[model samples]
Target: MASIETVTLEVADPTAADRFHTAAFGLGGQVRLRASEAPTTGFRGFTLSLVVSQPADVDSLVGTAVDAGATTLKPATRSLWGYGGVVQAPDGTIWQVASSSKKDTGPATRRIDEIVLLLGVEDVKASRQFYVDRGLAVAKGFGGKYVEFATGSGPVKLALYKRRALAKVAGVSPDGTGSHRIVIGGGAGPFTDPDGFAWEAASPALTN
Candidate 1:
């Protein structure tokens, strides 16, 4: 079995891609692409490469339908975490831009390392069971609501919290059923844990 290794996000706008990097994710650096590098179409690059989408030319269409509103974080610059920047798209969509050297370049590769992807759920027990039934192994933590699951892909941590509670953390109430939608590698979809925490999941965007 593979460990949780890489994650990616395919963004539309170059600006919002910047916001997700610096402001929200606290990353620094703008990973420059070389002609030798291969092209990617999903969050895999952003998560693993720590690289942002090209300023202009990219194969994929990077746009968020959630209308999460747009906000700039800082001037893009090079940093230890690859290309670091931030941008808030329409509908208050916040994105952290960064890549990691720990991404898989193979077509159907499995993860070998561990990186915890935090997800908010209303019922930790139910969420745990959901993954467990899917062949994920569950481990209890000191925090009651905290449950760790071994998603064959990697370590996906589900944090249980009430909708209102998570909303408070986001400093806003739940928007709509599909309020925050983000496109990943192939099939774009909206995912909100039981607590209404919205996010997009797919392969890693950039190379390791």
Candidate 2:
């Protein structure tokens, strides 16, 4: 099955982004901060999710992010779905620290187990088809409201959502300007998704 390799954010300041990702989250250079010319920006059509092993990890991550210049949009709280919260990075990137597992599944060393890149698309059906056509399998999904794909053995999770719902989950306005798209590329040949997101074949240097 096709899966997203990595997410590259085109930001104005790569240095701050690098610092934020390192301090706020334990990401080690997987986030490529390319330069961008678009000035007026908003939600950027997506929000990143950090799936942790424990509920306490959610609080720890949220606190760490706040101390690292991230704004707490929502405090860590418990819900039936599990524990989770939202925060905005120094560069305005929305992140949700969450754990679906109710208890420790087993002894694990890693804190974050997965990174789900949730995309806001115009047509959910068309977007789902775009990835399905490109060899991604549907893990689970609603009719047109949302869709989550199966990214077996891949670190990143790819999901589709209505633009407004995506914005609501991140606690931000859906409208935005500039290049507000994520390049879930590097694993497949170069092509543009239905919503204008770009993808390029995986580079040998970036492969982990």
Candidate 3:
């Protein structure tokens, strides 16, 4: 199964960035600090989504994020699809914490089960085809409005969205600043997508 080994973020303050995320989200994602490589602004064009199995987790994560210096984009609420909310992490990356149903995975053994990287692009069809050509199969989608691809059994799920619409979903503006501030490694990578999202070549450690 294909899996995203880890995500790499270029930030001016990698330590602080890592600290904030680790505290707010409790999932392990890596950060790289390169003064010369850091972008002037913050992340845009994408959102990191965490899927839990309980409605209460949606609320808990949102509260945790706010306590960790994240700004609440949307208060936790229930919808027919489930319950969830959005927040902008201290480093300016938006995070979505959600559960698709009301079943509790249980507090004693609960953990985030998935991290979906949703890219906001100008055209979803083009982006979908781009990945299809790179060997990713469509797992699910809604025409060109939104689409998710099979990224193997990796912990990360890759999906595409309409630029402004995705931002609206995250409760942010579509005007992304600086670089996209992300790197999705391990698939047809070392290449940039149509929107300039970076994907690096898989390293030896990731080959297994």
Candidate 4:
């Protein structure tokens, strides 16, 4: 089964991005950063989500991210699905800190249960089939709206969402152009998907 090993965000300053991510989410090797001056604007057509255990954890991560210079796109709020919020990093990457549990069972901690990379594609069904053809197994699907791929033991999970719907979920406009300013490192490698998401061979540093 193909799996996503790491997500590399192309930023203008790797050092600053590293510091921001450390202070904000304290992520491990799953999320990496590299320098790039690629011309991008508005929404990037993708979002990186930090899924936690409960509502408290969601608030904690979102609060920390805001304090670390991230702009809040959506304040932490409860919904039928769960509690979550959206924030844009100083480097312009949108992040969603979320949890399936709406209520807190205990005190908050900075523990993240999962990291999901959600791509906003023009056609979820087409993109899903594209990944399926690339040896990725479907973990979940919802008609032509969304699809998630099984990651097995991989560090990051991959999902697909319609571009307009995803933009609405992130509280942003749908129109965007230029580079995505992000790369996926996975076993599927060295290819660009239907939506132009680039995937490279997983780095030994990340796979290990």
Instruction: Note each model's CA RMSD in angstroms.
Output: 13.0, 2.5, 2.9, 1.4
Off by over 4 Å in 1: 1-3, 10-15, 18-91, 94-116, 141-144, 150-160, 179-205
lDDT of 2 by residue, 23-98 (tens): 8887854566777766647768888999998776787788889999999888888779988899998787899999
Task: List model 1 lDDT by residue over 93-116, tens digit each.
Answer: 433333343232433222112223
lDDT of 3 at 26: 69
lDDT of 3 by residue, 69-99 (tens): 9998888788789888999877777889888
In model 1, the worst 10-residue window by lDDT is: 56-65
Q: What lDDT score belongs to each candidate, Candidate 1 first?
A: 0.35, 0.80, 0.77, 0.93
Model 2, backbone clash pairs (residues 3+ apart or across chains), number: 1
Stretches off by above 4 angstroms in model 3 are: 1-3, 29-43, 103-110, 204-208
Candidate that would win on TM-score? 4
Better of 2 and 4 by TM-score: 4
Provide the lDDT at 103 for model 1: 32
Misplaced by over 4 Å in model 4 are: 205-208
lDDT of 4 by residue, 173-204 (tens): 99998899999999999899988899999985
Name the weakest run of 10 consecutive residues (lDDT summed) in model 4.
Answer: 199-208
Clashes by residue pair, model 4: none
TM-score of 1: 0.40
Write down the lDDT that model 4 would get.
0.93
